[model samples]
Target: MSAPEIYEDGCPICKERLENGSDVVQIRQKGADGINAASVQRGDNVDVAAGCKAWLNEKFAPDLLETKQDVVDNMMLHLQNMDENLHKGHVGEPKSTIHQLELERLRFVLTSYLRSRLRKIEAYFPHLLDQQRNQTAEDPLRLSPDEYIFAEEYANNMSLYFRRVALRHMPTAQQKLDLSKTVAPPDLDAFVFLQVKDRQERVLIEEATDDQEEYVIDLEENSKHLMRYKPIAPLVSNGAVQLI
Candidate 1:
């Protein structure tokens, strides 16, 4: 996970202060009350909204401006062994044994780094592609503003993974051997089955609820629900629920 994998509640004031799209909220100071510096992103005092915001910046901000071309260029420079010419070593004048060994080691590092990023991209790309279709739905992916900013980066990563790596140097005749691996399904937003473990009143805006009344919902201990992620994120992070 690119974001902090971390979530609970107490007090009537805290319950009342719950923001839209959150189960709870609490005000926290940067550095106050004789407190030492700490990670502001994930903490006992931080709530869902704050967590999501920090998650976005950590996961996606750095690549917000990167494009598909940029990713491809990077892959070309660093994502080695994809090119057909990797086996055709020592094209130029022969170098000393030490120099050749160093070059080989450098190639290994570059290839490993590229592979690591690609794996991360693979894990995260499905979520991102699901967001970008822009189709209207009852339960959409919850993304912070900063996460929206990183949409392009997600697109670029997908392009590199699917178009570049999957299709690279492959002849058209035999390409059909395995095309399914390149496919990204749009079923990311389907209801997730979770085992809820806490008894807390939760609220969210939905068409099912007809009146302007805050419903007191107690997730029965050791019970399961097929629900969307918006209301379930905090629960999962706080160990109140587990995705099944």
Candidate 2:
């Protein structure tokens, strides 16, 4: 998020001390001895009002500048934890090939999710700071900034399980059919197969019928291996196309 703008507070002493004009006034400064107050004598020739005004302005300006620095530090600290965790996930002793790929995938998923969510936050954060400062009626309908961040993190964590288990357990099956025909498999199966001609044109062909009995091949599901032979072009004929 872009840093919050700092607001400068009006000087207290200028408003309080110089409200009543005086040639000499007491200014307090603390030191080794507590409550070290001193009265600086000023002549009527000195424009004491302008000097007091400048002093108060100078004192408050640093405070206003420091507030912006504090906002930036706080934001950096908040994002730093996420960065450190993701970095640790990637760097370490060598792991098993499968385990390492899984870990990298998880890191990619989570970091991508965080970056996407942070982009949204950077867009909306100004309105949030305004709401906090203005003390307007809180909207019951909108998700707060904290709630939005939490929800995005939660979704990223949940998707890991979905990718690991649900996708891994996808079923594979083969069947033998009584007739020789090239068409889609029975509607009961999970997917449909296509034979790609060039990169663009695809010919929809049913899986080869099982030679043994009434069974049909699921070209789409079994085809995931990419190596096995179901010579698509070889199987093509007048009405039947090759099942590459």
Quickly count the clashes in candidate 1.
0
Model 1 Cα lDDT, one tens digit per residue, 127-233? 54455456466533344344445545766665667656665668876445322255443343446676665654553414344665644356777887776655555
- CA error at residue 180 for candidate 1, angstroms: 8.3
lDDT of 1: 0.41
Model 1, residue 98: distance off in Å is 53
lDDT of 2 by residue, 1-244 (tens): 8533211221111222332343232222211011111112211122222222222221222111001223223323423433444455445422222224333433443344334434433434333333344554643212345645554454445445555756446644323221113222222222213343222123333444665434334443223223222333222121132222
Which parts of model 1 have CA positions greater than 4 angstroms off?
1-122, 131-137, 149-151, 161-166, 173-244
TM-scores for every predicted model: 0.28, 0.18
Candidate closest to the true structure, highest TM-score: 1
- How badly does each model clash, as a count of residue pairs? 0, 11
